[model samples]
Target: MMKRARQDAMVENAAPQTSQENKKQKTCFYGSAFSESDPHGSIDWGSLPHHVILRIFQCLPLVDRARASSVCRRWNEVFHIPDLWRRFEFELNQPATSYLKSTHPDLIQQIIKRHADHLQYVSFKVDSSTESAEAACNILSQLVNCSIKTLGLISTAKPSFMNVSKAHFASALTVVFVNSKSLSSIKIDDTPVDDPSLKVLVANNSDTLKLLKMSSCPHVSPAGVLCVADQCHGLKELALNYYILSDELLLALSSEKHVDLEHLRIDVVSENPGQVEFHTIKKQSWDAFVKHSPKVNIVMYFFLYEDEFDAFFREETPVTHLYFGRAVSKAMLGRIGLNCPRLIELVVCANGLQPLDDELIQIAQRCKNLTAMGLGECEVTCRGFIEFVKVCGGRLTQLSIMEEVLIPDNDYSLDRLHLEVSKHLGRMWFPDMMPTWMQFDAKVTKTLQVKCGIYT
Candidate 1:
């Protein structure tokens, strides 16, 4: 007892270390001139501040953090810090019932028990197996005290192999929605996110929701989506299927109470090819949308059958970005000029034999805002191409014209066209080209670069 009292008295009487004393101590210990022993070997890691060590551990992944915590008792304490588990994603790869690529079940339970409340931005990216989905669902069901802000359930497996049906997924998600009332972004594509789960989400997170991207969810209907659009006035970005997009939907999004919408992406998917009995939005609705929110970008991606396109672009469409992955007809290309005045970027993956001469010219003349263009298996004559470029001028920044796309004749040559277009671009440019198989040696080429040496 007397010895313990003597040690306590010495500690109490010890002088507080000043900056100069600390610097001197560091120099004496670490910067001693020409030390024979290894300085790194004698370094005291325990002397480091808790915050500094925590920062170092914060930069590492969860697996690395766990491994590093085994080094000592101090680091183990730092590893268990609540701040370290605020944002996390479970990488679940299920090949069999016992297989696991991410965290083990025991580790996940520990995380839930200790740090579930700290989790703010969390996601579960799982493989296509039913086991993977079940694992993800199990983890989700355990998040009782979680206050997750952004949640994304991404299926790494193909949709065909996805056996974990919608009812189970939706049931699990309902728990997360009920808990995380401050959710701002959600991306649960191909999941069974039905109307009831959506209603629960809206009830909990309508005021805070900003972006929602659920493309190819078969269970969600137009009424369910309309409910979201009407309730979530703060929604700025949305990506959904074509069936949900309507006049009422667009007008609802353009409400005076909401801020100007930023991005509206539509996935025009086809369950059965050549299905023609599909709905299309009217032109009046688009006009009203444009008048209300002129800065909004409406990006559309088409994965439709050739016959299914007739239902789309029938009126003055407000699509700013358009991609035609299928073989588009000359009539459809022409309709793009008449209907899609707000079109800025156009990419045609494949088109029919009919030359888009007038249609190209009409697009360049009418759609003055057009900036980028890509034609893969489409034909446009040299004169028509030049006229299009002349109208677009420097604005056609991303022009990818394949060699086959330019059908040359006697009047407009590739060589002169390159020169004229280069003058407008203010820099040398080359069209993305393919080798001509038809009489390759006979094809004329364009050269934009000329070398002039000072010695010469």
Candidate 2:
């Protein structure tokens, strides 16, 4: 009798509870006339602030941001801002043509038309194949009609691999030579153009050309570069790799009135007459460089091998940046200390490095103004880094140590040698493979801010 009474009460409690739950579910799903149901996971574009949305778009890479604008009507209206697309043409690794093809081709063409008068940076990759080359030339032709201040064309194919006519590319490039009054910088690599075409390009548009680079171009000879130097008086920065830039060209640049030669990088792979190898900077060449202009502040040394660097580093000339691929011996460092007082940055990346504790200490003492340094793939242990820090404790600002150099050890128990570097927290960057240090965020934030010129 007691069991039956309990069952009746339990049934009564369960019946009201189930009915109340159903009422709540109905209210949530079908909403009452007084209140609306929340649409979870749905995006409310009208509610989001304009500036916040634009900021989010700006955070994306140039290529991504371009695509994001095409997603909807609201995005299309926001992307028309001028400041957002000023340097949009020169985004690193940005293939504008492919993105245009993926989306509405006519839409991209319209954007280009609207900004042609203000476009400044144009970067594109071209192929040696006829069809792709034609497409590239067409895109370039559109940019040529604009005020493209900087143009970089990276062709991946070997020069010998393609024997196409200069007329194929030059016919389209002629528009740039004639109309691009604001074209200041040009970088062409892995493809060599004919000398006559190069001559015509420079002859027609040399006044506005400030920087020119041609790397891995076997056909563009020393005579072609001489023509460039003779014509382009406003040339400030020039980069050439494995091409002959003759002494006559240098002399012409030196003698030119109102010449603005600031940065010159000559990477010679072949022994071309009239063009001096970086390793063989003679007294006359050094004299000519100094006499030419006081504006040339940055010079780079890119030797083909360690033997080349060994032959080159004996120069007493001053340079702001030095890049070599080997361990710098104490004696060589001593020579650099004596000669390059204004050295601001150094990069060492090679297999042959036997870093001495004393040599690094000496560098810290000598190079007071050295702000940036890159030690790429050196076989440095934690103990070696400790020694490195002991010498460059207060002054070291930027340092890159690959993960392979870290000593294998357990946590909590610091090795005697590693302790020295591990304790002093300046700005430290670690490879992703390594274990995260305790002070990772603080160090990265501090370092990135300083590197980005935002000191606080």
Candidate 3:
């Protein structure tokens, strides 16, 4: 009986010890589960240097980037870094159709408000609607009192949306340009704009507006442009499309007041060639037009045909940068190339094979200062490229070739042909070459992806 009592006492002691061990194990299991649920407690994010985090935030979109900044004061400070602003400018120019618009309009507005003040350029295409003016107004209002260096807007609208009154839109635009003290460039698109609106836009901003692009504004005719030329005497570049221009207007543009005009582009919508009055571009007229301006470096136009080029060349006209589509023939190219020794850039569209190899060779030989050459649909072989490269050597900085020579499939594959072509072209541009057809064909890596609906 004594031994039985001792055994019972020992069993009870062992039972309590077993229960205590079980309780300790259960606590450990729950503790491990809780630790996994909170990864910040387990992961050492503080180990990563702060600058690396800022770089990570810099790579994000403006919205996510802002969020990363708000996560901590260190990030908030880095978000305001000047280099990050440059990256933002570069990212903004990247094809805009790659982004997803924010679901929350207020969130987008806040994001825009934060960076709009820091922006040097704002390029956006808004859908044409009654809402578009309001949206544009909203965006511009944020940019008010900011130093906007460049502004480009492309608007697309349904047929019905275009019927709105100009005055109504003008009021909204006036608000946009109110305090843009440092606004330097302005590009507005195809809309029925009135002169008063334009006057208002240029009133305060004209002193600094060096570049102006006007599209589909019918009232921005030769007279209106002359007015602009008088107002913005410092204008360096002017691009116009679908504007009604006449000889009288061209005469006004030829005024000595526009001696600072360095780049000029004009495109007319009228099919009536006589309406443009080609006489305005005659040699004696151009000589008078350019007499006062010695700094005029670049002039590009889509007008003028074969006879016009011949006339201009025969008159001993000098054009520094010349671009002639299939309109001018090979003979004309040779004539002009022979005449204009100062021609530094030449762009020719191989149309109708007017400029044969011999003509191109002559131009290459004469235009000694030629720095850039663009050949589009010009039936040039490896022979032309190689010969031109040999002649131009270091002088050739930019060369664009659009045609691909297909090698025979019998003894050579497409890859080999492309490689050979690239090898030849690469030697010409050295380290600063564009991807030859071969490298573009071989590259198959995609590290980033974006999905955006096409608006334009």
Q: What is the C-alpha lDDT of each candidate?
A: 0.78, 0.58, 0.55
lDDT by residue (183-244, candidate 2, tens digit) is: 78888755546577677778677888898877666677778888888888888887776336
lDDT of candidate 3 over 1-456, digit per residue (tens): 999999999888874547556444434322431233454455333334567766787679777876777766776777776556532221111123324242246544544666556667766555534454445545554556465677776554432114445665566556656666656787875655567766776687777878877755664656566666767767887777524444444455567665457766555333444444343245554555456555566444444554444334664554666665434566676676677766777765444643256666666788787777665545544455455556776666666544332113454444454454345455423112334553322121010000010001
> Which order, best to worst by lDDT?
1, 2, 3
**Best to worst by TM-score, what's the order?**
1, 2, 3
* lDDT leader: 1
Candidate with maximal TM-score: 1
Per-residue error at 30 for model 3, in Å? Answer: 36
Q: Provide the TM-score for each candidate, comma-separated.
A: 0.82, 0.60, 0.59
Candidate RMSDs in Å, in order, are: 11.4, 10.5, 11.8
Question: Model 1, 1-456: lDDT tens per residue?
Answer: 999999999999999989676545554332342213554654567656678779989888777888888889988899888888888888778556335576677779888898999999898877767777788888898888989989988777665214676777777898899998899999887877898899999999999999999988878888898899899989988999888888899888877876678888898888688654678787788887777778888888776767777887877888988876567888888889988888888877677677888999999988978987877677888878877888888887777666677877787787777776677666676665565553212121111000100000
**Stretches of model 1 off by over 4 angstroms after superposition:** 1-42, 96-100, 160-162, 411-418, 433-456
Residue 253 accuracy (lDDT) in model 2: 73
